[model samples]
Target chain A: MRDEAALMRSARFRAEREQDWIKLEALVAKAERGGVQSLQFAEARDLASFYRQATTSLAIAREISLDKALLEYLEALAARAYLIVYAPQERLGGLIGRFFAASGPQAMRRSALFVAAGFLCMALGGLTGFLLYLESNDWYYVFMPSGLAAGRGPDASTEFLRSVIYDDSPAATGLGAFAAYLFSHNTRIAIFVFGLGVFACLPAILLTFYNGLIFGAFYALHVERGLGWDLGGWLSVHGVTELSAICIACGAGVQLGSAVLFPGQNTRKEALRLAGRDAVKLAIIAALMLFVAALLEGFARQLIQDAGARYLIGWGVGALWLAWFLLGGRSRR
Target chain B: MSLSRTRPTPNRQHRRNRRAARKKAASRVIPPEGVPLELPVASLGVRVAAQLTDLLITFAAAVSILILLSMLFFMYWSTVFALGALLFFFIRVPYYILSELVWNGQTLGKKLMKIKVVAHDGGSLTTHSLVLRNMMKEAEVFLPGTLLLTLDQTAPWAVWASLAWVAMAFAIPLSNPHRMRLGDMLAGTHVIRLPVPILLKDLAIEAPRAISANGQRFTFLPHQLDHYGGFELQTLEKLLRAQENRMSQSSAEQNRQAMTAIVERIRQKIGYADAVEPDDELVFLQAFYSAQRAHLEQRQLFGDRRANKFYADARPRGTG
Candidate 1:
């Protein structure tokens, strides 16, 4: 039989030199994992020697060896699980999340203010376009591509304008066409606003205000020309959803821009990361609204040429939108 | 014939020795696997998910806040009111509460996600930790952005430098084991996995008694030895008798002989055979030695084949 004392001496001797072996073992394990550079055969043998010495001491003392491969494999599995859980839903969530994160209370207040401002500007823009229509004594020419004016001036209201909005083609594609155009346009606008955040929202603010004023001008012109009811019914059909989307885009843009400008307690980079998240969410919601608006404007509104029917549709969409924005969303969580 | 016989004998003994060593390395005293170790810092993926979730919740929360703030701002900016009423509760309150609560605390996202917050020492988070973590947000998110926003077409060098600085600060967690952010380090708070439910009552037994390798009676706690001033042969005779009474079989008798030889060797080495009997300290030491020696002898005879070479080489020349 082997001497028990000699065995104990060997175990103790191995324990004394366990540290070098552990390092070598770790190096070899890492090299085998392919995350490290190459090693010589001598290095590999040295690592093996260290592993043997450590294993011997542990067997004598603590009675265990760590399983390096199992630990790494488990870590990798955990990382992959995280990616699955957090990544998929993030696409839309990220868009809207940024707007909320950037503004907090500010986003809500700015949105409300912008909504009111949008109404005013749209009415104003409509009014200017109406004035231009009346000046040329060509109210029906406003919607015509041929009669459209140069520069930023409003186009004359042409016969084509009213006819096209209300007309049904053989393909019956007015609703789908308008919906596609409106949805794509709104999404583009929202993204543009969000991207322009690099400029601290100078471009976004100008864009929002320009659209708002144009809308206001359009509304004012009709009201002044004794075409208030006709215009109101026409605008309300698609206007509620379309305009709501524009407002949302502006909200997202403001959020992105504000993070850059006021980053306040947050670092500018961190704030941008946050703002970017919220803006994306808002942009998606805007796209959904635009889709609904275009369907109403091109199909439902155009078919219901009766002033009263148009008025009712407009009021219904407007009320629904109002409820969505204002009193409808009450802490569902 | 001697070489063939000796070769198999040594190979069997060597295999037994190596097997014993490997088993000792894998056992941990306390089982930590099932217990939830608090997560100090989440990886990058978790951080991004949390940020995204907070944004949506904040947007809803922000609407009300923004409305009030805008009213106040409009009143002041438009000069419509004699005095501007800045309702701190509307804007600042939610901002402070939500950032600390959701971003650092329990943002709706985190609440839905099943994670929690704690100090680095594994204590409940304090108010100071919350404020400090949120306050550093400006440095984390905005200052560097201002340079990019303002100097877009000009001072490319300055913009790049500022961006690099910001990235470095954000990447600080990557370099540390704990993955602490600037605020987390300063406040000594950590985001961790919530404690999972566990039932200890389900265990049938805790810490069962140890059994001797030779099937002899064994006691974990030390006690006074009954026999005193006994010679090595006398103790072995007593142990053999006691063991015979406890176990019945030819194998038991053979194991007893092996154990006796191992114990006598240990007793001779420690120079404790001359000591008087019934020494509690000696008995305890003897018990440990007995267990170790028995295990080693069994391993030498029946363990890994490669390990027996040491003993084979140590034998007298031409012993085979």
Candidate 2:
């Protein structure tokens, strides 16, 4: 009860300063609504000074008086001012340029081991399937899912194989659905290869291998019918980007999966977070690659009949990808 | 596997935070390291709610699109169906990736929940981070959902694998201080609740004395003041404010009861002497306020605004 003089002093202080606070609050509201651009030079200066005064008032109000209303008003005002004044923004254009020109390639390079592991799985699986299918034709069915055959299983005759490959009619009905299905399937598989990499890349590696095995069985079946080069031309157009994208997706997954499994000196969560920065970049790039592959398969594959031109375009695209991965973003002195 | 214990309270979990803070303090140097700041992570419940909201929204969008497509291609039911499936799968791609991009890390659900995604390093959200996290969503969440819906009969192992993956998604966040799922972990992003702090309004009081009329303020030595830190100071400040308001209240007896409880707690906390009179609550509070304010202001000048007692004791040692 004897603290009455202190309470009077605090209330008196608030009465003296209340007008300035109301005026400043109005100014801050204007600034927030229209951005700092709405304020004149003098008004902006006044706002800054008011903010400083408000923060100081907050500190004083906290220690010297128990005026809870005044304290809260000042605290809220100060916090709002802090957020508005110190709002952080990064330049989108500059960051985008920097990321693609430097960070993306750097991340891909860092994930080389994962890419190699991915490629190794696919190549070994492909080799196994090629030999197994060459030994006997039933291995094709064993390698490929029966549901996924799309009428290319072992029962299909040599005539059917050659005719489908050469069928370049402009009027292709039901082909849109087929194209959509293929795109959906390929995208699903690519994403699948990347996603399952979280299991320390086991499932991803096996999937890449299984994909390659199916490809190998298909290749062997075509070769036995003396249409190996024709089929190569047919596939090569998009295979350049499609296959490499699969490798990239697998690599990105391995980057994440192994980071969790190993984690190096950091904790598992920390390691995964760091590796994720790289993995996401690679996965997106791989998705982009798949899109390009789909575009090529849809538009260009039907138009090109000569095996030589297909080989030229396909290998050329592959070389371009190699150059991109190796030399896209190296800074020059 | 039951995560009921780890759920977030509006106030950070007292028990977990206290233990972690203590461990952090015990391991830290006297000066502390990395600022030893405390930021609350969003709870699993809030995150799950946000996710479900997003799913409901996407489902509605897919359904609307399917209806339109079906009507447009009324003759081609199969095409309509396939396109619907494709849209269902992909509608989220633009919805999530673009919303987070344009809004700088808030999807509609996250925005509604007042939660936002921020970089793990406490930086601004980048396009790459958004893309990466959303892309990983294929594996982290959607794949499991898809497997559950389809349940491929030929691939029995796939069901178990999807279930395990989903289980890991729930399990992983429990292990870290930040409740980060796989996507969050990979994207190096975490969600934070943007709290607009609600201030507690103390009741009105008639003018009270600046200094007690009897000159009966409890005196304390510098060492006695040092016994309590900023955390206790803030608490005491709250107690004094409440008591100030209570002075004019109808329930004088209840006010006295509450004031005595607070005074007793403070006595035990700071090891104040047992010599203080029972009727001298106001005097003790007045004396402590002056002493603690002086202590804090002095520390502030030395650039040590110890926000709480935890800041005082958290000493960093070498770590793994």
Candidate 3:
């Protein structure tokens, strides 16, 4: 009687254990059927524990004449459960990382080019305005005020030039400094635009060319006048660095666009991310160049009066800008 | 116990039973794997990238239009080109709208990049969304707005005054959880990475590639099912129902052994001579069944042994 009772009890125990496993399997199937939510942290952890216990129970049940369907079912359940619970988040992380890696550098480079172009365009616009002023009937008055133009009144030109060079007011001095920062910031924006080309390269191109148009229009206004020589001397002092920054920004933008537009072996996102990574430093460098240009514009170009001295300052600044950009400290290209 | 009563009295019916269980499991799992493809999730990076790209592309278009207009004015053709620019305004917006609406939100440029614009729920983009996204182009002026001041002699400091406001307006996207710009939110559209196909046999135990904890149970429908006849399909399905019932009655260990035996029986009946050597019962069962289905399908259809092996080998274990 005891032997029969024990056998029955063991059978019942096995059946009960199987039933619990089945429940666990059903939960997993439900989760898999539902989506990734079926494998949340808590449920996945619970499933993991269930799998361990089930494995041991399964080993014990192996000695008896268990159903084959039950084993197959358990095996499938355990596999799915373990994958959801114990697998590291490497794939997701890797995917995101690759995406950034591919786009980041390219973005930075494009931004640098945009900044350069923006500065060049704007400076050229200023030159254009100067030329237009020269064409006016009171051309000399515009340059040095009425007194200086008359050549017999108080030398207010000296005072005005001095204030422009040395005054601490935001417009006279701070504007130059801010312009330097803007040059760099704009470059960075351009880089961001280009590096995100997987989304489309339109933004970078639009930004780069928009600045170009403004510069063209502004310069056209100046060229319409007769002060082209004076305008050239005034702008070249800062235009070199500013314009280079814009070009660098454009390059960065192109990098981003190409990354997305041509994601060779990588996904579009991955390519863009990689390009963005490379473009960041380029943007910083472009900003720094713009800052240097701002200092020259603030102190040297506006204040200087002797045409010869102005020409010399402009040449020196242009040389330095070219040397640094074309063959700089790092020579990244 | 009920499944046991329903089990075929003949041992030859065991292979048929296992096959049926596999089919039922497969039908449940196939959709999940491809779900990521059909319902793509737009990540923060993608959204940001999309916004930036849109900004650049629009800026380029604006610059081009301005240049074209300027050239027309310079050439004494202001009326013709100014009208052309105005025409572009009408044409450009609709071009983008039509492309996105008809081609799953893929603009020519986006299509080239293999990225597409989609709604938040991963559905098709709407016309309203297209208009909203494009209208945001007005905010994309690249010139430092100094020109606005330079042109507006009445408001000389307007450029400087509005600079801060412009900067602040552009900065809103930085705060968004999804890195969305105003246009993105208003349009209810986002950019997402497209799906790349994954091979079935490749989803094995590499530890790093593991999916859900209950990996074994996540069976998908194998492609081989297209070949089964109505009566054979019915027979296989009935056997699977019997297996599901029998599984409830047995201990886990006893269950594994029985499954292994059943797979072996199926291999023999299906005339899969090499499948008899059972290294891992589940693996053998999957490979053998897939191979048998392929072989049978080919014999009935193509009668080409070599061609059939290629399709059979391509069949993944327990996938839809």
lDDT of 2 by residue, A93-201 (tens): 7766876788878878878888888778778887888889999998998878766667986789988988777776844334355446444556667887888887787
Residue A239, model 2: Cα distance from true site in angstroms:
2.8
List ranges where model 2 is wrong by over 4 Å: A1-88, A91-106, A109-113, A136-138, A167-179, A261-267, A298-320, A330-333, B1-38, B58-75, B85-91, B199-320
The first chain of model 1 has a TM-score of: 0.56
Candidate 3 structure quality by residue, lDDT tens digits, B44-143: 4554465456545655776677677667554334334433433444455556655555454566566555565555433334454554455433333323
Report the C-alpha lDDT of model 3 over A16-110, residue by residue, as the tens digit: 67656766676566554553355668776667667676655544443331223333444455434433332222233453354334333344433
Tell me the lDDT of model 3 at A147: 21
Per-residue lDDT for B1-320 in model 1, tens only?
Answer: 46565555777878877754543321111111221121324555676577567655554555566567566554233222111112221333346444443333555556566554455543344554554455444334444554455444534764785577578656876655455565455455545443222111100011122333433333422222211211332343334334425566887667656665554554555444333223232333445433333343334344312122254454468644
Chain A TM-score from candidate 3: 0.45
> Per-prediction TM-score, please?
0.36, 0.71, 0.31
lDDT of 2: 0.70
Identify the candidate with maximal DockQ.
2
Q: Comparing 1 and 3 by TM-score, which wins?
A: 1
Per-model CA lDDT versus the true structure: 0.46, 0.70, 0.46
